[model samples]
Target: MTREAMAAFMFRMDGTSSYQAPKVSPFADVKPGDKFYREISWMHSQGLSTGTRQTSGKPLFQPKAALSREAMAAFMFRLEKPKAYQAPKVSVFSDMKPSDKFYREVSWMYASKLTTGYKAPNGSRSFGPKQSLTREAMAAFMYRLETTLRLK
Candidate 1:
């Protein structure tokens, strides 16, 4: 599933399905003519995603591109917007360090038991932040999220 689809599904699950606003759509690719236009626009408005391809001056959501683990963590973290965010001292995944872009979010995900990531053959765990998010993985994430929020 695309990031926009994930955002829209999450928004729907959060009980905020109403399209309320003078919608602000920054990406030219996701127009009103598109299928997930409103959902993508809403996600952007909520600050869950900044989209991709910004440095080129032509921002693109890359809607068809696979969503990364780090990006998913960031999305979940932003969606929650915890009352108090404290970064963990120790890293849960060997691949994720404190200096990584998704460090804090991944830390929160780990602390909350939202994800366990993938275990390597060497007995080390890797978050695989750059890997593509699969449908089953997204479902698992959403299940954990909804259960945690008691939204089910």
Candidate 2:
């Protein structure tokens, strides 16, 4: 996907169906070499993200950094925590073993029907985790997440 496409994404919050502000733009043009590459602590302070990968205190927004399967799951799940959630028990993909930091997030996505399965890395599953998610997948996932929130 193109950077422009990623930049177009508008993060939405669940429950009341409001949009949670996104801190970073996937577009190269949108990211200036400044606070955009701050640490997860900054993301938390800004309510824009929940830093994973534990990269560094200075984890960049790297907007085009293709959304991984687990990453996407976590992203989707994170958007819907307006109330308490039990999350899901893993019983689907074997490739998704435990010990993965995103295990809980993956389960949440499955339980909520936000995701069916992980897309293959070779464009087989549409958009692989290593690849940036298309505008379509983002919308679908967010829509499902919002639906789950409403049901709660």
The 0-to-1 C-alpha lDDT of every candidate, in the order given, reads 0.78, 0.49
The candidate that wins on lDDT is: 1
lDDT of 2 by residue, 49-141 (tens): 543333334434455456565666665555455356554454465555455576777766766667776666653322133445666877787
Would you list the clashing residue pairs of candidate 1?
none
Would you give me the overall lDDT of model 2? Answer: 0.49
- Pairs in steric clash, model 2: none
Candidate 1 regions with alpha-carbon error over 4 angstroms: 20-24, 53-58, 149-152
TM-score (C-alpha, index-matched) for candidate 1: 0.85
